[model samples]
Target: MQILEIFGIAVALSIDAMVVALCWGAVQPTIKASHILKFSLVFAAFQALMPTLGWFAGGALYSLISAWDHWVAFLLLFFVAVSMIREAFEKGDDNEECECRSMGSDIAWGKLSMLAVATSLDALAVGFSFAMVKTPIAMPAIVIGVVCAILTALSMLAARVLSEKAARHSKKLSLLGAAVLLLIGLRILFEHGVFA
Candidate 1:
């Protein structure tokens, strides 16, 4: 894939991480630099690693599923996007304290690892696609990981900066997140000939 295309795909895959980080930023008293770095590292590392793993696994199964690869991609992305949109719409109390360590659990490393893996599931599937398409997974995976790291950190920063004025606009942010997801879902469907 071309660089721009890879970047686009990376962005699409990173949206979930970005949104979660935004939520984390909003709930925290003050977003710390360390928090951003932690999220970026966990997210980026997982994003990078999952695709290579998927590529290897997918390499084995690619022959059996070559024709359905695009469809699988479309389904995975579409579902992920839709779920994000749905989560964004759910009303919730924002009174919970935000710790840089864990979302709702103790065990910092374990929680962080789980969060990273949870957020990077899409990349796992994309890795599978790389195998199916014979795309060089290393470059694209690196690109995805780096971009997600930057974007997640930036999003946390942005949400922290905006939290003061953004208190009233939380729902709007969620809606915007949802819209981005829907658009990505549509793009995937269109790309896969779901509309044709």
Candidate 2:
């Protein structure tokens, strides 16, 4: 895959992390630099790691599925896209109020780890898709991690100013990410001559 395409995938995969970071930023009574660093590092690490794991798993299965790898990749991306769209429409969590009330200034390592893993699940699938399409995982993984870290950090830092607006329009942002993944999936199909 081209660099631009990899970058697109990276951005698409970072949406969940970005949204969660924004929420945390908005709700926390005080956010230290340490918190931001810790959150960004954890998110980035998971986002990068999951895809690498997926790539390895996909590699193991590649020979058996080689004949129809393109289809598998497209389907995986489609599933992820659909899931994101579904999540976008789900009602806001009632627990958010409680979270905001309870969240203090310090970082919670356990919760951060869980959030990181949760957000990176989509990236794992993307890595599998990359393996199906025979794309190199190194650049994509690095780009994905870096982009996620930057976006997460920015979202957290900007929450003070944009939190309310971001919260209101988060669904739109999610839909946009899903659209990007859908388009990327279609492009993969086209490249494989599936659309020819």
Candidate 3:
């Protein structure tokens, strides 16, 4: 039962990453197998690390801001989502020809870590919640990390294949990704009484 509960939460959490991966694939249709592998590893490492970090932080900091963590998570997710929306609408054809291969291969560790940390900020709050619920720490964190890694890689691959066959659909894909982020952000806000 606990495993199932954790799995459900992990899936819910990974929806954002999976959607982002799809958009990444759509924007850069020339993604390679190596790119998939590299991104999956990067995403997985971060997803896995975030909850554990959050759990530790929770132990040390939850008492300091117990009432505000949810609001903070909501704000962080909203900010990130808003950024995605803004980027989606940006008119920078300068990057249309940019190859995913070069970028993936040359990904600086610092940037990768930054992206990982940025995307996984909500997981930190989720980790804090895990402490509140008294859930065992290690298993859920591992599950969420592994599941996100696999889902993100699969989404990227599917997006690449679809984009190759239907190049014109890239805009639609971006819109869909934006919608996912918006929904996730709104959901977070709603949970936090921001909408109430």
Q: What's the number of clashes in each of the models?
A: 0, 0, 0
lDDT against the true structure, each candidate = 0.70, 0.85, 0.62
Give lDDT for model 1: 0.70
Q: Model 2 — which ten-residue stretch has the worst lDDT?
A: 93-102
- Which candidate number has the best lDDT? 2
User: Which candidate comes out best when scored by TM-score?
Assistant: 2
Tens digit per residue, CA lDDT, model 2, 1-196: 8888888888888888887777778877777898789988999999999999999999999999999999999999999999889988883742322134344566579878987998899988989998999988998899999999999999889877777677677778888889988998999899889878
Give the clashing residue pairs of candidate 2, or none. none
Ranking by TM-score: 2, 1, 3
Better of 2 and 3 by TM-score: 2
lDDT value for model 2? 0.85
TM-score of model number 3: 0.59
Question: Clashing residue pairs in candidate 3, if any?
Answer: none
| TM-score versus the correct structure, for each prediction | 0.69, 0.93, 0.59
